[model samples]
Target: MSLFPTYKRFPLTIVSGSGTTVIDNKGKEYLDFVSGIGVCNLGHRPPHVQKALEEQLHNVWHVSNLYQIPIQNEAAELLTSTTNLDYVFFCNSGAEANEAAIKLARKHTFKEKILTFKQSFHGRTFATMSASGQEKVHQGFGTLLPTFEYLPYNDTKAVQDVQDDQVAAIMVEVIQGEGGVIQGNKEFMEAIEQKCRELGALFIIDEVQTGIGRTGKAFAYQHFGLDPDIITSAKGLGSGFPVGAMIGKEKLAETFSAGTHGSTFGGNPLASAAIKATLEVIFKPDFLQSVMEKGYFFQELLNEKIGSLSVVKEIRGHGLMTGIAIHTEALPVIDELRDHHLLAVPAGPFVVRLLPPLNVSYQEMKRAVEILAEVLDQITDKTINSD
Candidate 1:
């Protein structure tokens, strides 16, 4: 028996992690800027989460959603309290959270079409994959779910060109993490929200990658000051535990009543335990303030160190969710960084994505910036010689 080869496996294999660092099977240590692709916001094996899980493990683990699961209700409450969204529907992953949002939009609006942005990534599920603007994800999967449209992300012109009653929802990412760290323009977001209102459409914000202090905010939607009818979250929701949530306004959430939606393993006791622990740490004003401060410092450091390199095109991001757009192929730099014991992932074609844990120290940020500078300097030197 063998596992499915769904991912393009990296060369390295990690054995364990503590704080913002991980050790590989070879006993080599690497600074984990990837943070499990933004899942370990509190870092690996956080004490609070560990204790919570242990306490829950001693109690019941799984139960029917039929009875009152106090912990499940508590997790939902924690999520709803963080954002403008009134209620929550728990699930297992970002894709599931997004799927729930899609279903809710259609049911609440009594409409079909869902509008998304070009280069945005929702998830890998059928509806979310169809909703994704990246065509590559849809390559082998023929016949996606119907009535989904893709428009230019952060394009105000697209906002002007809308038809009445044509869309059930206009889904967006405040910062398109998988789209090479493209940040949404303020005016652009305002336009989308206004358009959704004009067309009687739901505004859905996919914060799967940006939520839970990844961008120094409870939800990136909070940065825009625009209220969304629906917002989906996952990635860092449970500090690496597999948990997700689709949060929405009370009026819209009410449409998803008995038999309309349900999840078997979603919000089980163990998952809820992790959620409670993760939320307790991140929801604090001081913790989020520290993230905001560190994000500013990290972006400044990148500009100071790598801004002048010929291969560097731009650096864009808010808080810890940063991306560097380089001119040359990004793989060599990624490999070089790994060799230097720093781990970063790729976003789109030519960008290096940086998603350090929210609790990463200032000293760790300096180390990551130093490694990036060295690699980029070498690349620039090579390019100049070749030229």
Candidate 2:
């Protein structure tokens, strides 16, 4: 059978990756700045992640949740302790985590209304896509889940105007990854938290793309001093392996009773092993400090090189999940970077996103910046020549 033609794939097919570089089938090397859409936090095929998966292969791989899984317990312990949350539920992907969070919120509050913000990308599942504020993704997906409302992002009063006891939860992204790397305002987030409290509604933070060490902190919510009632994470949790988790306060988590929700592959031994190793490496003081330092260094380099370009409008985002908004469509820049043997992704129509591996070296970052500078110059020269 032919493979499904869903993705608009890049010209090259990557065969292997190590650290921040990937080699295509033709043996051409490219610096990976997108980090598999921010899933490869520790970079591609880190020794720790590889070793954990290797060791688990020698033992057991799949054991249903019907029985005890020690690795799952270890991962849960680490996640809860690191984030200071009380309970956790493991799933296979970010979409499932968000799905579980949605169900839990509604069940616990016995309310049907969920308030989300504009330009937010949650996940691709039926309910998650419905919850997502991006109309492009929701297009063609039939009638969405009911009682969901969309409001302008960063508007506290808009949220306050609709909040009520019937609201089950307010879901948000601390940093909107697929929505052009826009960071949420601190005041707006705090106000939403306060409103949720006042209305007895849960506040769910979808950190699927910004969690782990991507934001120079364990979780992006920590930066704003706002604690979410429930937090969902996935992309960086397993450092490439598929894993997702929904963590919450002890009382709030109780709503999920036996048979409430489950996944066959969630928290499997292999994925859990990867998650355990990823957390161990990322939670280290030195590693996290390096992430912060590198983020500043990269942003400085970008500002120095392309910040003043006529087509470059703004540079936004924190830590490694950065985006550069250009006056022109970003696809041309993305393609130019590929020609220069650097890989990146477009976050939106005018934003070129950079989500290099958290462990990306200073040297690699410098090389990427140089290449981007060259590409920008070429684009500017071409535009001038045409004019």
Candidate 3:
């Protein structure tokens, strides 16, 4: 059988990657700003991660979850110690982590409904797909999982107006990575936590794309200083290795005991090794500070380079989770960027998503912006010529 025809795959075929750069089979060099859709926060095949994986390969790889794994414990410790989350349940992807979080919320609260926002994307699983607020994603899927509601994102008044006690959780992305890089309003985000407290509902932050220092913070929720009840994370957690985690406070620990939730390959020795190595690098105080510095530097460069474009609306995001909102189509702009040997992805109809590596140097950041400037010029020229 042939492979299923899915995903409007990009035309480029990558051969190998080093740091923030990749090579196509045609031997063309590209500065990868996609970061594997925010998975390679540390860039591809980082020396430390490669070394860690090699060491684990020489030892044991998979040991199942029947027995305790010290490396898993180490990985868990790194997360718990770093964030307000008291406990962690390892899974295999952002979707699994979100599914686990949903299960825990429903189980713990004994409630049926979840509250999400418009343009929010959790995952592709039945439950997560149902949780997503975008209609396009739910168009083809018949019989989605039940009990979900949507609110306008970053609207404090909408949050304040909530009167539903049936809301098991309020799941939100600090920065809607897939929703055109839409950011959460600080006041609204804070109000969500307060409302959750008043309603006795769980507060869930979907940090699948913003965690693991993608936002120059260990977790993007920390930026708002709101303490969520449950946080789902993946993508960059393992620095390109497949690993996810659902972190929660200690009070709900009893709800997920034993058989309620699990995964056979979630925290295997190999995955744990990848996580530990990634954490060791990004979790360093100096390293995170540097990320913060780099994030500002990148945004500043973009602002100075492309600020005058009429088609461009704005460049906004926290840390490296940046986006360029435009009046015209972003697809052509993204294609133009690719032609210039710079890789970027589209966030929404009018948004060009830019998720550079957290460790991408200021010089590389500047060059990427310069390349973007050239692409914008081409886009403008094309529009003029067509007219």
Candidate 3 lDDT over residue span 1-387, tens digit each: 387877788899999999999999999999999999999999989999999999999999999798989999999999988888899999999999999999999999999899999999999989999999999889988877779999999899999999988888999999998898989889999999999998899999999999999878899988878899999989999988999999999999999999988899998999999999999999998988988888888888888888788678999999998999988988888888999999999998999999988889888888899999988877777777888
Least accurate stretch of 10 residues (summed lDDT) in model 2?
A: 156-165
Model 2 C-alpha lDDT versus the unseen true structure: 0.91
Candidate 1 C-alpha lDDT tens digits along 46-115:
9999999999999999997787889988888888888887888889999999999999999988999999
Task: List TM-scores for all candidates, in order.
Answer: 0.98, 0.98, 0.98
lDDT of each: 0.92, 0.91, 0.92
Least accurate 10 contiguous residues by lDDT in model 1: 1-10
lDDT of 2 by residue, 45-120 (tens): 9999999999999999999999999999999998998775898899989999999999999999999999998899
Clashing residue pairs in candidate 3 are none
**Model 2 clash number:** 0
